[model samples]
Target: MNIYIIIPAHNEEDCIALMLESLVNQTLLPKKVVVVNDHSTDNTQLIIDGFSSKNNWLESISIQSSKEHIPGSKVINAFYKGFETLDKNYDIICKFDADIILPKNYLESLVALFNTDSKVGIAGGLAYINKGNQWIYETIASKNHVRGPFKAYRKECFQDIGGLKASIGWDSMDVMLAQYYGWVVKTDKLLKVKHLKPTGKTYHKSSKYLQGEALYKMRSGLPLTILSALKSAISKRSFLYFKNTVLGYIKSKNKNIEPLVTVEQGKFIRKLRWEGVRKKIKI
Candidate 1:
């Protein structure tokens, strides 16, 4: 089956090249690589263009659509734009960041999993920051709404989900929608990759992540979603992750949460917000 990878990049010139190099070295290289340049002012687009001209396997698309100029909407628009342009014959499509470096066998493992399991709709690999020994499992789970850096989805499954939601929590929205539709999503712990530490300010600020979660949970029906979150807490490292989510829910009632505060930060508040009666989203 043919495999395609879509990278949504905005002002990521420094790291995008490294990621592209890894793709060239993949044991099971993707049939095509599409990098969506989201109106970057820097040389990010130039970098992609340089690679695409030299590497027949890589193709870059410059997207300056007005629909993608908004906050969360940009990512969803880029994702959908890539999905629309990607070759239809490809069986699998992967969504990844331009800052990540793939392990040599990353694509190999994903292709194997999809080929072996007919029921599997998406397979995500482990993502670590820098060369740090620690795994940001909780952060990745809450941020991307699933495993980050290495998410591969079946093309048909993606189409069935109506693509991605152009909302506050686009990444998590994608994974949750897959689960809601009975699609099997699996994480391969053995398959690992490095997300190079971002230099200067990062958009991945914790407050933004939590806000995404809060907005996502509210938009997608909080009661059932919180129950699922609780299940995630119970199943994975009950003491640390699960308890944290539960506590975050309980604490949201008292005050506005702080920045960089993960679900683990104000555990009770998150739980409270998830279970609140006026949890419906505004706009």
Candidate 2:
């Protein structure tokens, strides 16, 4: 299967070289890679250019965007910049972060899983974040969730979800949308990748409300949104986050922002969330 990768990098000078080297050594090398240098003021472009000189499949594009590390939207926008340069003829498409190191067999194992299950739409590995000299599971999210940093999607699944949302919950949104389209989402525990930096670290503080805004935009409704907000707060052990999320949701509602999914799709999302809540209750 032909695989193509897009990495959206912003001020990632320190880790880009290591990430590229890991990819270069992949047992199943990607056919093409485009790293969108999203307004990076660092030496990120230099590292990418150095790699591009050695690897034919590797390339880079530079874009000038806001200096603030706004997260989701910026990353997705950068992905699109790189996406426009590539052909649409690929079996698998990956959106990788700039500060990650994959195992040599990472891509190889993922391709094997895709080959095994024809219905599998989205698949990737667990993310291990640095914790006291040990790389531990980033347990903030469920193991079932394929983290945004290392997401790999089957071409059909990528298109089925209308690509990715340029919002806070874009990562979660893709999985939900994939299931809505009857595609399987799987996480390979064996393919754990090294996450060089912690997530949500670079996000602008002002963007905290964006998470709640995301729930509202996804049509999560009041009940699910409330539950989501609490779970997120508890996960991070932050009451402030809980408060911010609720406020964000209301703010979005007041502004009458657009919903990310259709009415039918929203219904599916609600049902999915309800099932999850019930499962926890039963347990």
Q: List the lowest-lDDT window of 10 residues for candidate 1.
A: 257-266
In order of appearance, the predictions have TM-scores of: 0.69, 0.98
Q: Write the per-residue lDDT of candidate 2 for residues 36-100, one digit (tens) a residue.
A: 99888889999999999999999998898878877688889888999999998899999999999
Across 1-283, the per-residue lDDT of candidate 1 in tens digits comes to 7888888888887899899888888887788888988878899988888888888978888878653234455666787788778658878888888888888998888878787778678886766664356644434343322453467889878876666656445555466556556777776677667777532135343332343244433342345446656555566545454444444444543344332223432343344445543444432
- Model 2 stretches astray by more than 4 angstroms: none
Which residue ranges in model 1 land beyond 4 Å of their true spot?
A: 65-71, 131-139, 142-145, 197-201, 204-283
lDDT of each: 0.65, 0.92
Q: Which one wins on lDDT?
A: 2
TM-score of 2: 0.98
